[model samples]
Target: MGLIAGIYSIENKAIDSGRHLDKMIQCQQHRCQGGEPVKYINKQIAIAMVNPLDSIFSEYDIPTNSHNPISGLYNGIYAFTDGIVLDVPKHKIYFESNGLPMQDNTCSSIVAAAYQKWGLDFMLHLEGEFSCAIWDEKKKRLVLARDPFGHKPIHYYSNNKKVYFSSEIKGILDAGVNPGIDLTSLSDFLSLNCIPYPATIFKNIFQVPPGSLVIINSLDIKIKKYWEPVISVDKTISFENAAQMITESLKEAVKRRMMAKDAFCFLSGGMDSSAIVSFMTEVSSSTVHAVSVGFEEEEENELEDAAVMAKHVGAKLHQVIAKPDSFFDMLDLMVFHHDTPFTDTSAYPTFYAGKLGSSLTDVILTGDGPDQTMGGSGHYVFAVKNNIFANRKKTFQFLSGIGAGIASALSIDPTPALFSKIHRKLYRQSLGPVHAAYDIRSYFPDIVKKYLCTKNLYDVHSAHNPYRHPEAWFKQAQGLDDINKYLYADMQFYVPDDLMIKVDRMCMAHGLETLSPFQDIKLAEIVNKLPGHYKILQTKNNQIITKYILQKVCENRFPEQILTKKKQGFGVPLEKWLKQNNGEKIKEILLDPGSLQRGYFKGKSIEKFVNVFLENKGDYFFPGPNAIAGLLTLELWHRRYLDFI
Candidate 1:
C-alpha cells in the first residue's frame, strides 16, 4: 500500500540526487508517510520511505534508518517497509513504530528485526505483504527485497555503475529518464498479460522476483531467490489429516490478517471469496462489513450470490453497480496507477471494488491464492486432457498429411489447407511443452499473428527473450506432473505477475490495503505440495472438480447449492459489452487509424479482428478478444504515459 525508493553508488560520491528521490517519491505521494530531511552516509548512499497518506500515525513521517556512533546516518541505510510487522523489540529503536511493540509495527522495526536475526538476509522471515530495503552500514552495501507472494513489488535498475530501486516502475522512470521498452520482453504482455521476473516493461530496470533479495555493494550486485514456489509434501500429514489441517491453517491466516482495525472482505459470490467472508465472520470479534460489485448484464452479475453469502454470514453488503461506461471511463486513471496495461476484463471491476471497499476500511482480505495453490484453474485440467491425447500426435500428423495431399490433387483449395492447419495446431498443442500449451491456448492463431507489428519482436534480442517460447518456466517445474507443472506456472507466472499486479495497483490506487489469507506463505506451503489429484478430482458423474479438498472442508459450511454451483469468478461483461451499440466504444478506440499508426499493429488486421469480434465468431483465436482489449489498453497507456511524456 506504499512505495520505497533510493540510490546507491559504486564510488563514494556525494549524491545531489535527492531531487531524483524526491521526484520519484512525489509520483506515489498518495502513500506518503510524509516527507523527511535527506540523510547521506559518507556521501555514497541515500534512503527514503513513503507510507499511505491516511495512515493513523501521520506524525511519524520520517521512518527510522537509525544514526550510529560514527555519524547520525549510521550505515547511511534508509528503509521503508509497508504492511504491519508481526514482531519487533518492546522498546523503540531507530524510529518510533507508531506505538507499543508488536501491535503497531513500523517498517523501521521490521528492518531492525531483520538486522537482528538474519543480518543481510532479513527478507527471509520478514513475512506478510512487504517490500523492504536496508543499507548495511558496516558493509557499506544496500539490500532490497519483496514478500514471498509478491503482493507488494520492488523494482530496481542497475546502470553498471549505480543501482536505482523503487516500489513502482514509474518511480524509477519519472526522474526524467525513460529507459525505453525492454527489447527482449516484447511479447510477454501479449502472451502472459505481464512480464516475468527480473524483467519489467522497461529495459535495464528489473523487478525482484517474489521470495527473493537483491544486494548491491560498490556495483558488485547479486540477486538471490531465498524462497521459491516449490511444492513438497509434509510426511506427517496423511490424507485423513487434510481437512483439519486446512481448517487450522485458515484459522491462523484469518487471525493474522484480521489483526488490523476495521477489516472487511470482498465477496465475489464464489467459493474462494465466500469462504473468506465466512471465516472472517467466525473469527472476528466485531461485525465484518462486505462489499460486492454487481453488473447490469445479468450473465455477468453476481449480486444474488453475494447476497446469499452475506446473509449466511450476517454481514452488511454494499453493492457497486458496475456499468460499461464507468469501466471504460476509468481507463486513464487505471493506466496511471498501474503504470502498465492489463486486459483481464476483471481489472476494471477489481478497481471499482477496491474504490468501494476503501470507503469502509483500509485493509480488505481477498481470496487470490486458492486456484493457484490448490490446482483449481480449469486450464490445469485442460493441460491434463491435452496430455491424454499426446500419444496420438504422430498418428494425427500422418492423417493430416494425407488429407492435405488428397485435397491438393482434387483442387480443393482452402478446405485442405485449413485441415492441415488445424491438424498441425492439434499436434503441437497435444505434445508441446506445458508452458507452450499454456501460451498457445491464449495465443492468436499464426494466420492472424501478422496483426502484431512491434519492431522489438523482429529484433536480434527476440531469441533470448524467454517469453517467445516459455520452456524456461515449464522446465523449472521439473519434478511435478503435467497438471502440477501447469499449476506451478500459474503460481509463479500468472498469480504474481498478472493477478497480483491487478489487485495491488487497483486496491492501492484507492488507498486501500489488501491481504490474502490464501496467499499467506505458511498456508501456501502446506496446500501447494498436496497430491495433485487431491487438489483436482474427476467425479463418478463425469464432473471435473477443482480445489477438491477445500470444497470438502466447505461442504457443510455453505449451502448445498453453493457446493454444486458453477465457478463464477471476478470478471467483466466484455463479450456482451463489445456487442453493445455495435461495439462503438471499441471501434472508436481500437479501430481508429491513429491507433494502428502507432506501428504496433496493422490497421487492416485490427479491422478484421473487430469485425470477427462483432460477428461473434468462435473460429478465431481464443486470445483475439483479449488481444483486442490489450490494444485499447496500450493506446490509453500511450495517452497517459508515452504521448504525455
Candidate 2:
C-alpha cells in the first residue's frame, strides 16, 4: 500500500510548504519502497502517496481513460488509499484504489460514489484493509478514514494553524514541529509492548483510530466511528456447521488472497499456518514455497513439525536456523523500522523471515489473527479454566497438584518454585484476563516501574488503565461472554498494534506484501457472532482445545501428534540472545550515558535490570527476558528516531 501525507492550513495563515510535505513522505517511503506515486495539492492542502496498485505490480499501469492527473480536477478533490479495494468495477464510476487497474476501487472512487448515492452514508458499503484521504474542493473540507480492523493505519496531527496527516508518525514529525516523546505513551509502550491509538509516542500527532474517520474544514473538525466488529453471542448453527463454515470461508479468503501470480505461504508449523498452507496449495496452480524459522533448542523450535507439513502439502520448505548474533546485528534497523519501542522479541524472527521470504516472492501469506480472533491463546485457556474457581488461590493450589502430577509423571521440575509460578499465573488471572496479560506479561515490574519511568509510576497513569477494566470493550456487546471480553479488547489493540504492526513493518522492510486469510471480514463476522465458548471447545474425551474450528480445518492434513502441541509464538531465543557476547551490545545501548541523560527512566532501576541481565540469571524480573529486550529496544528507538531531540 502507498503512504500519504498532507498539510491543510487555513486561508488566513496559508502556506504552500510543499517541500516539508515531501520530507514527510520521504520518512515513510519504506512503506512502499519501490516506485514513485503521484501527489496532488491545492489551496495550501497537499497529499502525498505511494499507490496501492504497486502492492501487486512493481510498474505503474493505470487506465488512460478512467482517471488521470488532469489539471483543474486534481486541484479540487484529491484522494489516496493505502490498501486494496475489491469492488471498483461494481460501480462503473471513475474510482482509483491501491490494487492494479481493473474494476478495483480507490479511495477517490469511494468518495465519489458516496456523494453520488448515499451522500455521507458511503462508509456502510466500504470494505478493505485501508486508510484513505479525500479533499473536497467546493466545501474546502478534508476527510480521513481507516478500515474497521485498522489493517491499514492512518495518523494525523491538528493544530490551530494546520492539520497534518500521514500513514506513519514520521510524516507528522517531518512538518518541522517535532513534538517530543509523549511520556504517557512511553510508559504504556514499555508495559503493553505498544502505544494505543490517538496517542503516538509523540504528543500532538495522533492516530485516526480504527473503525473511525475524521473530517476537517476551515470552521471545524469531527471524527466518528463508521463500523466495528459486530460481536454477537447469539448462534443457531450447529458445531459441525460452524466448523465447516469456518473452514470453507477461510479457504475462500485464502483463495482470494492468492490473486498474485507467485504467492508463497509463511508456515510456522502451527495449526493456523498449516491450515493456510493446505488451503493455499489447494487453490494455487503451481507449487507454493513455505518459509519458517527455527532455533537451536528443541523446546524453542518447531522445524520438525514444519517439515512434516511441508511434506504433507508437497511444497518446498525454506528454513532459516536463527542464532542470537545474527538477530542482534540487525537490531538498529529493526528499531528504526518499528518507529516505537516494540519489545516483542519475536519481531527479530519475523524480520529475518520477511527478509528471507522476499528473496522468493513479493507476496506472502501469514497466519496471524487466529489467536486473538478465535481465542487460540494458551493464556486464554488458562484464564478460562482459572475463572471457573471461586477461591482461585485454593483452586490454583489444586491445579498445582495437577501440574505437580504431570511434572512428576514426566520426571520434570516438581519443585516449590514450579508451584509458586503456577500460583502467580492463576492469581494474576483471578484479577482479570487483560490485567493478567498486561501485568504478567509486562517487562518492567512494579518495583522497577518506580525507577523505569522518570515520573511517579502510578502518577504516570492518572487516567484509568484499559487493562484493568477490559469490560469496557464489551459495553457495545453487552450480551458478549467473558471469553469475548478478552477477545474484543485484544482485537482492538494487541493484535492490531503489536502483532499486525510487526507484520507490516517487517514485510514492508523487504518490499513484500503479506495477506492473512484468518483476518477476513466475513470470516471474522461469522466467528465473532457465535458464542465465545466455540473458541475453546471440549471433546467427549475431556480434551480441551483452543481455536477449535481452526484445529478442525487441518485435522486430516496435520498429524495426530501435532494436535497436542501447545501454542508457540515465533521462537526468538531471547535469554540466549541477552547472554551472548554480542548481547552485551544491548546493555551498552541501554546503559549509555545519553540513554540515562534523557532522564525518562530512573538510573538505579535500570542498573538493577542490567545487573540481572548481565548475570544471565533470567528469572523474568517482571516477565524475564522481555524486560531486558523491551528496555534495550526502547533505548535503541530513542537513539534512532528521537535522539536528535
TM value for model 1 = 0.88
Model 2 TM-score, all chains together: 0.86
RMSD of each: 4.5, 6.1
Q: Candidate 2, which segments miss by more than 4 Å at Cα?
A: 11-13, 52-60, 63-76, 89-116, 296-298, 388-437, 445-448, 454-457, 462-471, 474-478, 538-543, 621-623
Global lDDT of model 1:
0.69
Native-to-model Cα distance after best TM-score fit, residue 130 in candidate 1, in Å: 0.6
Worst 10 residues of 1 by lDDT: 65-74
Q: Write the residue-wise lDDT of candidate 1 on 401-423 in tens digits.
A: 56545543443211124554454
Residue 616 alpha-carbon offset, candidate 2, angstroms: 4.0
Question: TM-score: which candidate is best?
Answer: 1
lDDT of each: 0.69, 0.70
Model 2 Cα lDDT, one tens digit per residue, 1-645? 467788888553656667988888888877765657567666568776775452242134554233432134233455667765444444334333432223323445544445434544556676555677877676777889877777777788877788888887777777777777777787677666677776778787788877887888888888888877777765787777888888889888887777567769898888889888888888888998999988887788989888898898888899987776566657778877777777777888888788898788767888888899888876677666656313345565566556644544443221124553554444444453345555655665333465456665447654545353344564554556767876887888787778877887777777666777888888988888767778887557756689877776677877765667877878576776777884568667877788877777777666656765576543654337777777777788777677676
